[model samples]
Target: MINKIDKLKDPLVQEARELSSSKKRIFKNKIQLRGLEQLMWAKYAGLKIESIFISEDQNVDDYSGFSSPTYQTSNGILKKITETNYLIPCVGVAEATPNNDDFDDFVLLLDDVKDHGNIGTIIRTGKAYGINDFITTNDDFDPYIPKTIDASRGTAFKVNFKRYKTPQSAVAFLKEKGYQIVATSPYGKSLQSTVELDKKPIALVIGNESVGVCNEVLEAADHIVQIPMHTGVESLNVGVATGISIYELRLKEVLTMLAEKIISSLGRKVSVTSKLIRRAFDIKLKEISEFSGDQIIFLMVLKRKSQMNEEQIGEQFGYFGDRLEKFISPLYENKLIKKEYEEIEITNAGEDLLAKLWPIHEKTENILLEGLTAEERKNLKSYLEKIQQNCIKIMKYEV
Candidate 1:
């Protein structure tokens, strides 16, 4: 329900205005979000909204879906609550950004970086490169400040961050977790692009605007790297430099992952490719059905053979014992499949499910083989069949 508030003296309005102070925000465990875009992004990140205050002229429908109490107020009250002279469609009070301890393969470390704008920009850039985890020195730093959130374009909630009392402590933690610490310094002998980065996790540290990386972090880093610049230019902004470094490092990581996937042994390559194909199929299958790719594949096998015993099915799919039972239970419970004595068969419902799912299978295959010619695809299938037969023969010999 939307309430009408005309006075700045209202308790909720005063509370909203008080959230502008960092100290009060921390004490109340709430953060102020200004404008529609920020509120939308906050909701997308699953942040809980306590209340919303909007100008009387703004549509109440836009704020309705938040499931929070919204109040329609005068334009002056809206400006006062958000501390902005310009017109803001709405202002939201949301739960403080939650901490995320799950670190990705790459982490960005902020060492005494005081500029909220730069921190936010780094976060935006890091998100672009699939780096969502960050570590920073815990002092007076607040990543959710209004300027930081604005600079991040509302991505501050999408990322995860952890804080350490000092940069040295953060570096030590990363090292203990088997991460290779790469710190940026203009004086470093190694160029950013040329630095050796393998498949190991990395912690890339960006430092303060005025002084660069702290001495302790620089000395502790596994690799001190620098971005090359024109002779007259000393350095770039910390945010810009971070963007360039993240791009180069992420590109290298992708190339490395792809190279390993393709250039490994034949068996490994086949295994990885099979996993990738299943992952792609699962993503597409989710849009149309609740079943997983493997479950659908099981249904397809039953359709092909009409019926098969447990032993026969095991031979084809390599599932047995509890694993087999766990896989089959869902289908049987859902009435998609039925059992007759020792034989298993697909029900009419299963057939219908397959009819709906076959197009997704074909589409996923086409997407995977997008650039390959028909002849190449045929040859590829033939090669895989031969490899499968050889593997079966070896398994039979071992048995």
Candidate 2:
């Protein structure tokens, strides 16, 4: 339900106004959200709304249905509550989003970044590039402060932040957790993009606006990198530099991650090898025939079976319905197969096409098994067949 508060003296209004003070916010354990976007984002992040105060001119219908109470008040009161010259349409009082210790593969370390706006912008940029965990040296820094929230465009709600007593302590903790510390500095010899990265987790240290990364953290870092700049230009803004660094460094991490997954994951290896084989077959078949590798396989299946009903053909190649019809229609039009009722049989033309395509298949297989001896090839086939049977059994059990 919506209620009317005509005076600034109302208890709810006074409480919300008090939240403008940092000490009061902590004492009350609530944060004052200034605009509708902040309120929407806070709700989206599952923050509990203690109350909402909307300007008297705003449509009450727009503010209704929230589980928390909403009050309509004059613009002057809203201006007073938010401490801004211009009126904000809505103000929200919500429980401060709690911080968690959980860290991801990519994290941002803010070293003595005193400006709330910079912190907010870094968080916004970091979140955009898939870095959600932010570490800071300031124990009392509030991520939900109105200016920071405004700077972040409410993305602060989605960010997870943790505080450390000092940058050294934070580096120690991350190092213990197996994170590779990469600190940014203007004096560094290596460019940000050139830093070598592995598959281990990364903690990128963005330092103070005036001073770069601290000496302690720099000494501990696995790589000290900088963004190249023109000779006259001294440095980029902390937020801008952090954005650039995060993007470039994250890309390197992603490449390292992909390489590691390709090397270590059996499923990934099989999928990649299958794709390469298909691609090679497709290229080789194009030189010898008009049919695609899959289409030729379909023709070969018919030749092996002698004849198959439509349903049985679909089952053999995992194609059905319109897809199966689409696959068969072209071959039928070309007179490569004969259809009687629901049954299909390969024609002389289909047999002739397969004969021409068979050598390309043999050549592709030979290229794939170039280094393998005869005995090794036989054992490899046996192993693959066993793996395929195991997969089939697992699928059957699950079904």
Candidate 3:
């Protein structure tokens, strides 16, 4: 049942107030909320709403599926959303914990960054670029504040973050686990010139706005990095600096993601092209015979169904008249084929060469037909042949 407490001294109200404050910290599973936007976003993220408080005149239909305890208040005491004292139409309390997964090789650490708004922006920007795990030093502002949530537009609730007692402790633990510490500083090498990211499993530290990274923390960094600015500009906003640094540090992942998108748009045709297949076969079967692609393909056709005369061979393999003669004469001189009356047959030497190259040819076939069922492979071959005939028709029509 959703409990409604109108009095300011109610125990639930006290708990909500405490949960909403930064100085008095309680590691409760609940978080403070404000506005319809925050409540809706929390629900969209699939968080469990513990309870909700609404104004006396507001209809409950706006919050349909949530079956939590609903409270209607007239004094607007429960409606004081945050320290800003804004009386929003509705407020909610939802489960604050996110579905946290294992951390990636790259991590973002905040060192004594006391601004709540800056912390929220950092979390929002970090999540956008694939850095979900964040660690905060003890002096850093609490991420659960209403200002933080408002600044992030409720993205703060969706990110994975942990608060550490000190920057040194966090850096020490990360270093022990093989993460290189890279701290941002105004005096450090420019981000464009930094080569530390060539090494993986890096922890990028963004510091307080006023004091910057603590001297002790800066001393512990494996590499200190900075973004270059124009001569008159002294520094960048912490949030902006962090965003740029994260992009530069994760540039490899960003490029790989873009390449995958391009490849996906073009389909897997890149892997199974005619040119690539021809090159692979040439390289794989070079030892058996010094035959070109046309010669090898012609020999394979005869090997499967022998005794093919000139016109019949042309019909079967698309070789005609002079082209057919060119393919056969070279094989005849090499003792690979014999002329038996009107029909041509592969000679003993040809059979020996085919036997030597059979395994490689079959392997090449398997590579081309990979990830397909037997039926699909047959259908694909039929489709390709149809496409080839269509191409021939289009060429003849143009001529």
Candidate 4:
């Protein structure tokens, strides 16, 4: 015999063997490794290895390539294990539990996903997408099974996984923590197009292989989103679907966060609304006439005042002399403005252009208040007036 069989009966070996069984184990503080790959993964995850057992033919020096210390080995039952089609050359023991509270921002909820392969792939893919927290319904399938561990490539050791008695329990927990529950289904709005995920701290629930997300869980969700599919393909493997959804949703969240950061940083140095107004005015002006924002302001002012001398317009807008004239020249060339000497007036064409431009301005305003209620709009207007008052006070050097 190339290896000893009595060593497999060691307490640690028995623990590893028992862990491989189908029994449900909670709060797993110890993980059993079956191969060098899993041991390497455990090392990478910073897990403290309690012990290592390798086949007699394998050299400890070869396995000691990792950061972990070399260990004494025995040819235990591992060498004589004929039950499994493939012999596992090594088995490792290490820490496996993660704090439930450590998961933040985004979480993945698996609903009755019975297949170990699917669960493993989901964890592996979710980790790639920045999802560290995984919750599964109380099902018989063990996420730490050798098959799952093998498929996850040991990513299971890195994930903060928790099991709930039911999907409803998971949803309730997330909801209580202020997470927006987004459920995946084949029948809902397109995942790519849905803006529901604009809300932060998302808890994405993916359902079982055959029946999809449970009805109770779906009913509890704040939004139902689905991936658009081609004809004849009724559904996707839960693992594949979860991976796709996580990629799309997590990327959106990251992009949204980056945009918010950029906006905040820019807000300290420049006016966001002012930039938007200038850009939107330019775009709207392009559609109507060859007028810049300054010229449009002058046109609207002239329209309001019915006509004004260049000096008077300059006094009102603080734009005078050659600069004022230069600004008006483009408008005049477009037939939107007519100037005789110092007096300037808006022509019929200018009036029509301004009329068309009013809708664009309205559209922009509507866009800003897309989801706001009437009361919110009223409050916003009041708030803007207060801001104006504060600005005036600052200009006057008032405290």
Q: lDDT tens string, model 3, 146-232?
A: 778887877777777776788788788777777778788888864634544544477889898998999878999888877888999
What tens-digit string does per-residue lDDT give for candidate 2 at 267-353?
Answer: 988978887987778888999777777788878888988889988877766779999888788898999999877778999999998
Tens-digit per-residue lDDT, 1-399, candidate 1 = 889999999999999999888778756667898888888888998899888999889888877678888999999998898787887778989987666666878899998888889988998989988888889876456777888998998888888778788887888888888888888898887988888776678888988999999999888888888899999998799999999989887776667667675677686877788889888889999998888888899899889989988888787777899988987899999999999998899999999989989999999889999999999999999988998899889989894
Give the Cα-based TM-score of candidate 3 against the true structure: 0.62
Locate the minimum summed-lDDT window of 10 residues in model 3.
191-200
Better of 2 and 4 by TM-score: 2
Off by over 4 Å in 3: 1-11, 23-26, 79-85, 98-101, 139-141, 252-399
Record all residue pairs in model 3 with backbone atoms less than 3 Å apart, i.e. clashing: 2-69
- Displacement of residue 270 (Cα, Å) in model 3 is 14
Q: Give the Cα lDDT of each candidate.
A: 0.86, 0.86, 0.75, 0.75
Error of 3 at 281 (Å): 18
Give the clash count for each candidate: 0, 0, 1, 2
How well is each residue in 1-399 modelled by candidate 4, as lDDT tens digits?
122345656675566565555562344556667788888888888888876667766776767566444344544466333136566778766767555766678998888888889889998998988789987777454677778888898888888977788777878888888888888887776565565465568888878888888999889888888789899998888888888888888877777677666767844434777667667767766775566666667778889988798778776666777887686777777888787776778899999887877777677668767899999999988987887787778889855
Point to the candidate with the largest TM-score: 2
Worst 10 residues of 1 by lDDT: 253-262
Give stretches of model 1 more than 4 Å off: 6-11, 26-29, 83-89, 255-399
Task: Name the Cα RMSD for model 2.
Answer: 12.7
